[model samples]
Target: MTAHGRLPVVYFPEADERLSSWAARMAPFYAMTVSEFVAALGLKGHDVFDLEWRLSEGQGALIAARTGLSPEAVQAMTFRELGAAARMMIARKSRSACPHCPEDLHRKAAAQPWRFRCKVHGVEFRDATGETLSDRFGADCFKKLEGHAEAGAAHLDAWACGAGQGDLKAPEVLQVLTARHRRASPPNVDEQPRMSLKDRRDYQDFLTTPILRQALTVVVPEYDQAAPVLAKPVRPGLHALAQGSLLQCFALTVGIGRIIEDPVKWAISVMLVSDAEGQGRVRQAISPWPLSLKRRISARFWRAERDERARQSAEKAARQRQSHKYRLIQSHKYRYRIS
Candidate 1:
């Protein structure tokens, strides 16, 4: 191979690997930046920017010749052939990468917005630049959360395919679920220290929106109302918050999964439907199920909602009674002479 042809053999692409990530890994073998590598292939401007789109025949030939791979192999590696709806699932930003992966290997699935942990290593995914999003947070929570992501993805795909009728858009559903997670587990000390004051305040507001709170309650019937802690300094609340966030995220995904037919099958397939012991874990993950075991949990949630309304009503009545009594007292005082 010539000096210009000194590219690494294309790393075997994972099921969901992005073409961009593959290019990034190949860049080092050629001793060039990813952009430089793509530009050298004669792709210009926007073509270089959009790696998911299939390369032109000439561009494919150029890369094939340089890498000593067939044009068919080059084409197979690109995600550009996937349907438009499928492409939306790929995150535009490289949100996470696998820490345990070889230096030259980055799993494309990790970069997807819905994925939380590395499938192979069972570790928390890192941010685009390969830094932990929260040092205090552990991978265990994310691993648990990932078990439910398949269910979430199913719902998302269904919606994208126009299978459901709902007021919420697909993006809104994801945002609401993420907000629920943020609320259930507010940023701990490790996460807060990295944020600016304004960002912290904004994050607090984002988590506490009325819609998010309602969504949280719907998904997690056992959820308790936790007051915002933005005014206070960050403290050591990592473990509890991590666990809460994981549960919340998983609950939200299960709730989304409930909309599909045969929800139990969907949930089970996403989790442990095969193993008997694992089935118990799956049940625990999707507890307070408004779908599976609907009668018991649904009744419980209804009772809780009724009790909340009654409590509010009692409080309003008590305030009204006090106001009426005060008015009567004032009337009597006005009728009588000044004491």
Candidate 2:
């Protein structure tokens, strides 16, 4: 059985022919034949058919290097014991679906993970509530979604489980999720539309529900939290909501009317969710509606205020000029004007 945050266990019957095939696929990577690889691993007291690791490919590679194995072998091993290792990995990778709403603003500044409580409606994941957000996200997707670690753990897990839902085939799922999120978002008065705290909460809640979350879990069974030594930090916008980087840019769809501008660049950034079928030049990159995005909105408001001020100033200046001219004419005509 799978334990939370551990690799899924595979229970391939000893008599299965796939066992030999699994070994064969892994042999070249490990510099051995199927029999040699199995014998080598078995000699090392590792259940070659049941070995498991987190979803980090680098980590898997590291483990393989240390064990004198190859990347392919490590992955194959994860798949071979797909029963127990896979379950353990998934349980450990669940993320909290709660939205920290209004107060979320403050929590983001402190940069603390657990300080914020549920501020928005429908932020709760449980209808269990005992599970911490950390526990919910487990260890895998939590890091990647946050941009702290890599984002392909789900693909790796799929491979290990023989789930046939690897990197090449996972976009459809992401597209659907992204679409749902887009449809629920409301338009703003300005050119750019930002998701409100309430909308984000509702969408997040729906995402964590069993229907979608389970599908993701099936497609991506294991995740890794460790970042590679050279891995770059995640951009603030792409960072997940849990990190308080709202308005993560997903897709850049064309403006049917005036609502959307810069469709080409926006679409490129969202390439993760779109496929060749929807491919186009990046019109613009729509990032999360953070302070930066709000600047434009604030600027528009400021410009309007400034324009009104300018108009009032002009009117006041004109009145003053008229008064001064009238006073001068009166003074010229009558020497004792004040009296």
Candidate 3:
């Protein structure tokens, strides 16, 4: 339908260019909209945007034949080669953009959370407002997690590409990191009665956030000193973060590296500072860890539980003895009836 009976217009896909981007660019040459161009090719029930990640071989071949490009080249323009892991991490819309490239020429990697730089230009990506990862985390603070993010990014990229199926998956690591380590501390500011009505009411609302007087502070204990303030009982997990902002992805990337160093140690250390519920949460959260690692964690967890029970039992006995002595003293006083 496009330039009928004439030779196909020659248009090459940019390196790492998304299939959607190529079709869009070529659409105007034939005076057709992207959707019309795709429809004319007979790929019905297929969204133009999804072509980046979900194109079938038949569809790829059809596009190739119409565009005068090989099927392999057409497939390369999609996420077909990146594997499903990258598919899960790909944002529905671009999260960051390359400063040097035109908006229409963004690469496929730009939509992937693991990629911090432009695959085509080798430049760091920036948010819509021109904020880079370094800016979100100040240059000095970013320096702390940058190394971990780099190494973790590589590890994650390799794992997603099916390189390390035997190792722990990224989602498990993130959930384990989210296990609450420390109880929430009282807000730094105090709520005193007799304050203005507005102030007192605000304070009341803060404390009474439907609470059993427990302020649950869910956090990554290792990043306690640096991570941004997070909402209570809400920890960063892979699903909550797969399409997250650059900063969120960066944090998870650092966490992936930090825990991989000694996953068991991190789990135990987090358990130590947590309450009974928090500890139990960790015990359950680690169920997906590899078998050998799971055994080691379980052994340590049971030992710690036994020790805590023994200590509590000893304290209960001491309290009973003290209560008995106090009763005897009261009976003696009643017998004497002295002033």
Across 1-339, the per-residue lDDT of candidate 2 in tens digits comes to 111222222223121122334445456765666556645543334443333322257645554544544566555534334434233222111222344332112211122112112333434332124543335455454433333111233343353355865223222222322332121122223312255878767666433333211111111223112211111122221122223211111110001111122222223233333333322211112233334433554465456557767989999999999999999988887877656
TM-score for each candidate, following the candidate numbering: 0.48, 0.18, 0.72
Best by lDDT: 3
Q: Which is the winner by lDDT between candidate 1 and candidate 3?
A: 3
What lDDT does each candidate get? 0.49, 0.33, 0.67
What overall lDDT, based on C-alpha atoms, would model 2 receive against the true structure? 0.33
lDDT of 2 at 267: 30
Q: For model 2, what is the error of residue 232's alpha carbon versus the real structure, in angstroms, after optimal superposition?
A: 20
> For candidate 2, what is the TM-score?
0.18
Please report the candidate that would top TM-score against the real structure: 3
Instruction: For candidate 1, write residues 245-274 as lDDT tens digits.
Output: 333333455445443334333333333212
Clashing pairs in 1: none
lDDT of 3 by residue, 190-241 (tens): 3223568777677765644431111112223323333343322333566645
